[model samples]
Target chain A: MRWKHSDYTGWGRVHRASGELARPERAAALSELTKDETAPAIGMRRSYGDACLNDNGRAIDMSRLDRVLEFDPDSGVIHVEAGAQIGHLLKTFAPKSWLPPVLPGTGFATVGGCIAMDVHGKNHHGAGSFGQHVTEITLVTPKGEQIVTPKKHPELFKATIGGLGQTGPILSARFPLLKAKGDVMVVTERRVADWESFIGLLDTSEATYSVGWIDATARGAALGRGILEEAETGGGLVKPAKRGKKIPLNAPGFALAPPVVRAFNATYWRRVPDRGRTSVKPIDDFFFPLDKIHDWNKLYGKNGFHQFQCVVPLSSVDALRAILEKIANSGLASPLAVLKRMGPGRGGYMSFPMEGYTLAVDFPNKARAEQVIRELENMTVAADGRVYLAKDALASAANIRAMYPEHDKWLSAVTKADPDRAYETDLTRRLKLRDPA
Target chain B: MTPTWIILGATSTIARAFARLVAERGENLLLAGRDMAELNRTAADCINHGAPSAEAIAFDARDMASFAPILDKATATEGAINVAVFVGSMPTQDEIDGDPALIAGTITDSFTGPAQFLTLLAPLMEDRGKGAVVGVGSVAGDRGRLGNYVYGASKAGFHTYLSGLRNRLGRSGVHVVTVKPGTVDTAMTWGMDGLPFLAQPDKIASDIMRAVDKKKNVIYTPFIWWPVMTVIKSIPEAIFKKLKI
Candidate 1:
């Protein structure tokens, strides 16, 4: 394929970037692609922002680099191709009690890219992020190929985990797999008519999985009414896994706006609560309800859509409420707004977590939508929580570093390993993120 | 088997350029065609050019059923076809002068065969979720001109199929690209009467590869054609029916 350094994945509202599109089949190919280039690597083209973009450089399409090399069912660890999709692994190995340690919603994403992006999920509040589960990564460093784990290269490991592909082109990874109890979960649905109910639910059960919210203005007189779904992987086989094999089909374009989503969310919430507090959901329903539609992202339409996800400290839940009220007051067609909780930030220098609240809102990113987001980001900073790098469409680099606090140490490790700055990506270039040294 | 790309149409100037482009980057190159010697020579040339791995797998994209076994065997030897580029095709306009039966057969070979192979082969890429299928089309398909309209129609149909596949396979992480070259200088266009501008196969291949990387749905090789074809395709038949474009 043509090696282009391009980045148009996120923000048609923003400037689209570019990258190198080199295909690497094996180790030698991987090394060659990673050869002292000023570009970084790109996978599955899912990043909503410039993370996958490296200006005037290159991006090795690691999707083809996938190869499930080995598996230890007992140990629940897998040696796989850097470009392998998590969904594929779940189908083939998850049944046998093996899965990628970290899985993002874009199941088609490459494992290596996931680690590079350090994706997190609903369970992120509990498990931190995908990188947290990564035991080791095979790096095609400019120096040479080295199998680096935490112990092998502690500094580089941390940096690479959240370094956003600046450290090196991740060739493959050896990750610990979890024994999946089918793609099923025990979910409890509760309607939060206002901010109080929302916080009340959060204070109660510390579920392994959680997420939900509604733009009450979109829901008519039900200001701030929303459903909060909490799911837990309770031990024990529930039912035989349907193990659906049908590939996701394309869906018709249906806009989920404040009005439409509020109606749907209201209906959905009513059904859930009526059915009782406890219910069973397919893993897809619980984890990635949107994954079923192949190009569901396009539903946002030609202008494209952007999700602004940020974590706000517990003390700042009031700030989040103020922000929601502000968004509601604006009277824009916001169909989707999510609220979740974050725990401790283990070590990701740019980690977006705190013992606080996280809110992710999906907006059709038209022109000037960024300005609105920046206003919210200002509020987040004021609240002492930060925007998630993974889902952020726009967050100033200074803001990111300021929020994470470990920015300096993170860059030190990156600069040390990638001395030539040969691994800059769109995300790095956009925020002007660089080695502090 | 660690995964290798076995290009079936290695002799076409377009195919050769793609091989050279990929080989230049240090990947394993395996060329296959009717001309075994040319295939081998190209394989050696690819290796010399710096491909990390290179080999020749003799097969044809025209013969549909035979391809599965050959592809299965080759991927068995090398891993799987991460990106398969179909650059082999019969000359355009030949269908105009040729018999209807012959035209249908050629069209099947050119269109249905590749489509079948793609549908069959898609499962593997889906299993992998990272495979991409790049098919070469022509801007002639933008509108049915007097010169190469039949061929253009087939390309258009093929592109439509590609759109469906792209949509169907996106979640599986596989991508399909439709490369519509505005005009290209390949053996098929050697002595054609009048042509204003024609892109070099290598240059066009370069554009095709980039579109593939970007996972773009449809790409105009030179980028200029993006607008040119838009205007051309948008031309009203009522106004244009009076005069040829």
Candidate 2:
């Protein structure tokens, strides 16, 4: 395999990596490359932070290795190469009434990336994180190909899931697809008046899939005001999703200025009526709304952006509100913000979900925004919450360690799996995750 | 009756993509390749994608002995038995220069092997009176460049052979499409630098299917290669040899 020198970035585009990348298209080629020299495996680079970046080193690009190796219709189990995209899986199986149990905000994320990040979805409160659904994982370690499952090698399995690809390059995975009513989603959108009501609505929601779109720019009586979307899969026919449009160039910086954002948010909030509205949408439309606009990250312009995401306990709702208040006062928050409830279902030690409320807001890559995110990270730690590593680009290692109490266990497991640290990436180094210190 | 596409070198990136395309249309597939494991996986994938029936058969391009069984299996299904040949090899010119013995294998893989298999299958296509044959040749066949003249010469010979095959097959109502694709972003060109206007394997596959539907005999994929190759082919041999691309 020839290694091509490439300059790549995370979804945020705030962090960049110049590295040599080898994209192997077959399973034998992947094993052969890993046997000779191990490197971090990256798929799609959908992480908003540097979790996928390996600067000044060789990395394996697994995109072309994507394929469905096997599928058992009776059991709904699928064996796929790690590079298979979650969206592609849904497209293939959804029509047949089988769907991936957990889908992140974007369908572009590969199965390997979902496993590495332990991503959650709109149905996270019910289906849990992506790793929780996986039955088996084939990893290429220093010794050779090792198969790890929840039953066979539980510790290594937990460490590999949401393990940030530190344990080894994942070769393939086996997971069961959830039976769906159909390929379409019946969605209900209701406007939340304020913070208290929004929290109450989320707490009482019985929908299979629920998420809140918060207008971070709102203040006072309108604080936390947004649209609450609840959805459930149903048997129906809908038009095929339109062809995705690409963002050809970086948008001007002024395009998302505070005044412009406030105006946009106001328009968006008013788009949903007070009485609420019900619509039938393509599964991808409801699951990955912004994906229709390809490279939507470029909307933040050349400087890129950072997404500050953290989940606080059920009791820490007040603390979460205070953090939101601080963000609103700072006037640096973008219109793109989400609030969701998570269940106490997580597969890995480093997994990000808990039984609590999670808030995620995007901020332009400004010095002031960095300072605000640092303050938010501290507040999250104080509230016994943890920042999501997938979306975090500015959190300090000390703060991250404080958030994930199982850090030592994860570190020990990773060390045992990769003693030579050949799989380290920019995120691992930045967080000092491999260091006992 | 549903058509059955016998894809030679089915493990190849382009052939795999073409298999999926035809499979989605509910066609039957005979994925013929040397790698049984990989070909079986692709066969299963094609089935999942919507093929009525898909099977993997062993095929070694250089071994003419492995060719007849694939034809016999396709003939068992009473319908239009189409074929798409994606078998070829290109050892870098530097490697070829170091080991001159590689030329024979290159010629067998890129030209003589598939040509012989198709020669054996042509009469069967004539008996059926309806089928499509897609021959994947590279633009390198248009003019031998300094970088890979030997590999180019093999494809050039295959292209000429295909032209004659088309003439004979046209009389029996069978269509032939000679596809000249530019650099495609497959395993073959994955990390190759300075590849111009590289197309995706899926795009080339779709283009080939469209050409079959339209019965276009010779076409350049991505269309841009047509004008580009035109310029190169028109250049006098003296200047072309002197100017390195």
- TM-scores for chain B, listed for all candidates: 0.88, 0.99
Summed backbone clashes in each candidate are 26, 0
**Top model number, TM-score:** 2
Model 2 lDDT tens row, A1-437: 78889999999999999999999877788888988889999999989999999999989999877778788889899998899899989988998999998999999999999999999999999889999999999998767789999998888999988999999999889999999999999999999999999999999999999999999999998999999999999998889789689998999999999999999999999999989999999999999899999999999999999999999999999999999999999999999999999999898989999899999999999999999999999999999999999998888899988889888888889999989999999999999999986
Regions of candidate 2 where Cα sits further than 4 Å from its true position? none
List TM-scores for all candidates, in order: 0.62, 0.97
lDDT of 1 by residue, B1-245 (tens): 34456675666667777876676656666676656755665565465445666777666656665676655754455444655555435544665576555556556545676677677777777777565677777787678886666676777777887889888888888778888887676536544546657787768878877876787888888888888888877888987666676
Q: What TM-score number comes out for model 1?
A: 0.62
Query: lDDT of each prediction vs. the true structure?
Result: 0.67, 0.93
Query: Rounded to one decimal, what is candidate 2's iRMSD?
Result: 1.4
Interface RMSD of each: 13.8, 1.4
The TM-scores of chain A alone, one per candidate, are: 0.87, 0.99
